[model samples]
Target: MSSPPAHPALSCAGLAFAWPDGTPVLDGLNLAVGPGRTGLVGRNGSGKSTLLKLLAGELAPTAGTVRAAGGVGHLPQDAALDTRLRVDEALGVAGTRAALHAIESGDVREEHFAAVGDDWDVEERARATLDRLGLDRIGLDRTTGEVSGGECVLLRLAALLLARPAVLLLDEPTNNLDRHARRRLYAAVDAWPGVLVVASHDRELLERVDRVAELRGGELTWYGGPYSAYEEAVAAEQEAAERTVRAAGSDVRRQRRELAEAQARLAKRRRYGEKQAANKVVPPIVAGGLKRAAQVSAGRHRAVHAERLDRARERLEEAVEAVRDDDAIRVELPHTAVPPGRDVLLLRDLELRHGARIDGEFEVRGPERIALVGRNGSGKSTLLRTIAGEVEPRAGEAAARVPLRFLPQRLDVLDDGLTVVENVARFAPGATPNRVRARLARFLFRGAEADRPAGTLSGGERFRATLAALLLAEPAPQLLMLDEPTNNLDAASVRSLVQALEGYEGALLVAGHDVPFLEAIGITRTLDMDALTSPRGAT
Candidate 1:
């Protein structure tokens, strides 16, 4: 059999990086990747993006070096495109360049040059790539400005695919993409040859990679195989580390007890020696020798105890480091009483629209937990807005028993200029300034942070602020509408939010892709948007 290939296509050696404010983001971090796919997993703010940028040659490391063997391509989490240009035109730039390069190098024969009939061929290729990404039937003549955010994402991917770089870096590629687009992306990734590194939180996508590398505290651990294998290995490692710490603790306790007993025995011997000396019942030399022996024994016991304590401390630190704390942000929604006879929400044949087509028709009742599941652009957001009274349905009547509170995916409900306390005050008008500050504190906003502008808060903080306002309302809204509430939340925050939702008896209509979270919060019913809206044989 032939030996496998050697030499990594990309490598970072002793890489160290820091932010402008002097906070260290990466500390002597080193990683290497050869051909094939590698999945990067880490808690939020773990420097995953910084490392990718370094590898892509977009950012310089403060210390050490990153090296890549071939052309590199990066698909940013949020890509900005020329909205005025059509999709074909945007992608044509790269295709044209490659064609020109080939022509200049005499790689194209006369016959091949003749076959390059018109620019439409290039546009066709671009459109085909987009189609493979589930953007089929979308005209190349359409302006990117008119495209949805999800389409923009697919366009970016199409551009990268056209370029066909030797190494690819994708950051959260599945984010904001609908299920169909996600499946398309997975298919493309599976077929692509060359070095590929993806940083994402999507378990389904990660499971497709050949290896999983977890980033924790500026260190990386690579586990061979898929996500499930990595998960099992991590679980076993944690269990072993915990057992080691426990055993060390027990040893320390045993050593302390033994030391105490030794001290007591030494004290008793010393007292007997001292009494003998006082009574002049023995020679002074013999009594002095007895006293010296007791002191020597006590010193030996002390030394032994110190050694055990030192070992125990080392073991405990090892265990602590082995099980690193996940730093994802979390939000806690406080429980509130629901008013009697409050018809939190009422929907009458509510119809949602996507472009000229009707997406779905549905009705919701008070205090219902409904999960909306569909492919991207299936009118989930439109449905939510119609319910919140933010958007009007073309045809149908919608009403809320009480004022409805909507938390968009972006958490834009709060005014960016207002401080955390001020935002909270807007929802709970009767709340005094002090009371507002207290409420914010319950969600981890305390001290002077309450006065900080909402725009300065992190993604997690913004979500918490929104939840705080909703829960602290004067007549607390019995109906809460959340769109992808768990997208940017940390593990801890997700857990807290789940607990709060479990205790909430009011109606909740959530549109999210987090299956575990949905199951945990007890989604009593689900609305399949695709089934309700599709025309005859549309699927």
Candidate 2:
């Protein structure tokens, strides 16, 4: 007799899923997530979000079984909490707490007693959970609208924690969170007791995981340790794959040379046989027999060389396929360079209606990179808009001496109806389509991909297209202002963006909550919008 297999915290066997249009996302996938923190990573459009939805029971798989030891809680990439929902209601304990209050007030209905059965300290637990998630000051009666977008995300996570599910799934939990909120969420992840699976591009978040699971082309590959370890492993694997490809390429070349040599020798032998046959150096029957034997020998030799060449070519193809193609953006903008002493932007006591208060003068000169950091609703976006000339400041002057462009958080610069090529052309009207396409190719939109409609592109691809438009515009922008640029980008796209920025020689003002990304892009200084607005309680 054999013992039964142990059940993991969560398991999926031969799972398959497809979109409504019959486009497959995951096919015949098998996964087992034991009790621990696991980081799920992949490129955009790789179905990380869809997989979480299936596991959370929000969507049914097209095939196979998904089993979990206990309840599952999932936080999606876009956690949309109703603005009017109260804190206690969002935590899922409003009914029970209300019942407790009613019972204490001498309204002892049987239903009220039933609602308040065993868990009488629900409010205490809710508050504790909220506190653990860094919402200590938040009142249970307050509505979600009173909090920031980052706070709303943490609030949802607190509710999930209150549920105490056996398995938790978080998708891009740190997307809009500021540094402080992200640190609190990281602590929560570190302290989670159940099977926690997070799909994120945040390097710091991934660093806390016990293991990394990479999903590529509908397949799951498990790597022990954190994101850094996974990157090292991947690098080693790529090195080996490249070596194999080189060896296979050499084998193919050798086989081709051997085949050519055999063909040449065979042709020479045929010519010799023809001459001997014509010279009548032997009897007619002997010459015929000799000619036939030589022909058979040459045919066998040629067939063997041809077969070896075919096999070599196949091996080379397989070797090449094993390597991952990480297409990166390559940009060169000499026109965007600003001299060291040149004034790029000047702001004089700019103030916005939304509590973003800049009481003093600020100027950006040369190729300086500045990070605009603040809590959500602190008017970082408003400040960027004012400098971009999209919004007028109420009390002061916001001016840009050099040519400037703004990349909004919502990516509104693009026209969804038009293709990416058309969008670039709109920004660079003087450039021909061929020239625009050639420039777009550097941003990794090669050939037909450049012709894709902006609406049809994935989040990362759309970012790239928007970036291409900005960089390829007429009289290239000397000052680039980006509002929460890394909000929805995948890790690969983030790296590509950094590389593009490295090539740019302009002044940068990027407002974002991603600290690692800011550091990676070489931010020279930081302006805290929260400090500027603290005196007025604006946000």
lDDT of each: 0.74, 0.84
lDDT of 2 by residue, 446-515 (tens): 8877877776555566777888898788888889898878877776667777877877789999999877
Q: List the residue pairs that clash in candidate 2.
A: none
Top-lDDT structure, candidate number: 2
TM-score of 1: 0.80
* Stretches > 4 Å off in candidate 2: 1-6, 20-23, 60-65, 330-356, 364-368, 374-382, 385-405, 410-459, 465-478, 513-516, 519-522, 533-539
Kindly list the per-residue Cα lDDT of model 1 for residues 424-501, writing each as its tens digit. 898888878887877777777778667767755545567788888877876766678888887656567788889888
Worst 10 residues of 2 by lDDT: 1-10
Model 2: lDDT of residue 450: 81
How many residue pairs clash in model 2?
Answer: 0
